[model samples]
Target: MQKFGNATIEILKDETLSKNWYHLRNITYNYTNSKGETKTLKREAYDRGNGATILLYDPKIDSVILVRQFRVPTYVNGYHGWLLETPAGLLDGDNPADAIAREVMEETGYKLRDTRFLFKSFMSPGSVTEVLHFFAAIVDATDRVEEGGGAAHEDEDIEVVVIPLADAMKMIEDGDICDGKTIMLLQWAALNRASLTQ
Candidate 1:
């Protein structure tokens, strides 16, 4: 990466820390400060590739679709394991829209016809090298074709949840919905409901 604004970055070393389903790399870089001082820093970044997430909303019913499942990371961090989140998964060589559509079908049992691209963000930029593309889709009753709880081989046991948009926003305040990406999408929906419905 080239110098940006007041800092210059140079990669000194990049070593793979782990390689299983995903990759973790330990990176050492030299940072040249504005004062021309160079400092070396090391950090480990988890690279699970890029991912996509989508929130499915039904304007006719004023509701949204979400999923609940056990998250080991959240469990180990002292909260209950189960998390309510929008359907999402890694791109895995597929385009963002295709990956999100597949994930939505697999996790929520809904085949999306048209999806609106919202934005992209880094969920955990400080330590993880993952960027997530966010999307929103309008859906109705006809979209559900099968019971989706994720693939059997993937070992994902997800529970589909459909709730009113108002209730979901309340859940965020009550700490029931805590996933970062989910929260962002919900807030976006709340703010742009009229336009989104149209």
Candidate 2:
């Protein structure tokens, strides 16, 4: 391990607080060098954290569940307002499986069961330290109409979309699914959907 530039934020320029997804400090670090000289350097310092996501599924129908929401970031840049994604959230408390299960239920309103572990890796390893734990969760879709999204404090105004696993795979090719978590979950299912269908 190596230590580089270290700096503390004199003041947090912008602070956004939420019951769920929240940003704290603005501790801007030079991230240039440490007590020793280095040969290479990359990014400065920015927001970095770990998170969890789940591909909730309904074994009864052999269908997968995903959410389409108006991503402010994506909309601000370019593309459609809705981004097809798995029911996911940050592991704010560090409990991997529990965090993912909670997110799945809140975002999709389908109580998850038998959340099989899928993947654990970073989302944007380049600049963001967003690590996500992916899972294929079992959910009850019989009452999907009444059960959708978490509380308002969750900042999740999500619209649930349930489709066949095969169709989701098609969306990936047609550019409908662009998020990393969704892609990873689908890739996982493609290899093990047969054994995990129930």
Candidate 3:
């Protein structure tokens, strides 16, 4: 796609909205449109730092390691039960690769030695400023060094699950798996199954 000319932005006012859990800001700005029209806009942006997620595939068994946990945000938004998702966590001051490696171990007990960085995305661009890094790694039974659940002091309660790739994809179609990052990584694995084994 051809690049559209940049829109000019002038900050009018910026204020902290909240910081109980993460940082939230109310920003007012002047936006100059492509047609040379200027308009004032106000928006609230939530910043929870950044995060990382990983898909641990066991090619030997054609399965992947996943986690199930209760998410208050999703529960209030309509989902009433725990969500099945790729092992993930906030960077918490660490870089994406190191953060994901630690997260995978904590969430699934899988020690990732050859994690491949897939891509990065803004999970919710309209209101959130979190950029999530995606990764994948090939794993087997030998890689699991502990009985993974979650960090206790952080009030995390997680259940580790291993399922075949085909079943995982079917869950997505059946609405059983609704997390965006999980679905994206699963789809990527499906499309690149051959290369992943190489």
Q: Can you rank all candidates by TM-score, best first? A: 1, 3, 2
Sorted on lDDT, highest at the top, how do the candidates line up? 1, 3, 2
Better of 1 and 2 by lDDT: 1
Output candidate 2 Cα RMSD. Answer: 5.5
Residue-wise lDDT of candidate 1 within 27-56, one digit each (tens)? 999999998899999999999999999989
lDDT assessment of candidate 3: 0.92
Which should have the higher lDDT, number 2 or number 3?
3
Expressed as tens digits, the lDDT of each residue in 1-198 for candidate 2 is 324245222222333332244333323222334433323332323354677788776767777888888888788789877898988777777588888767766787776557788668866666455677777766665545447665587476788888988888999999989887788888888888777865
* Superior candidate under TM-score, 2 versus 3: 3
lDDT at position 177, candidate 2: 91
lDDT: the better of candidates 1 and 3: 1
Clashing pairs in 3: none
Highest-scoring model, TM-score: 1
- TM-scores for all candidates: the values are 0.97, 0.76, 0.96
Q: What shift in Å separates residue 15 of candidate 3 from its native position after superposition?
A: 0.8
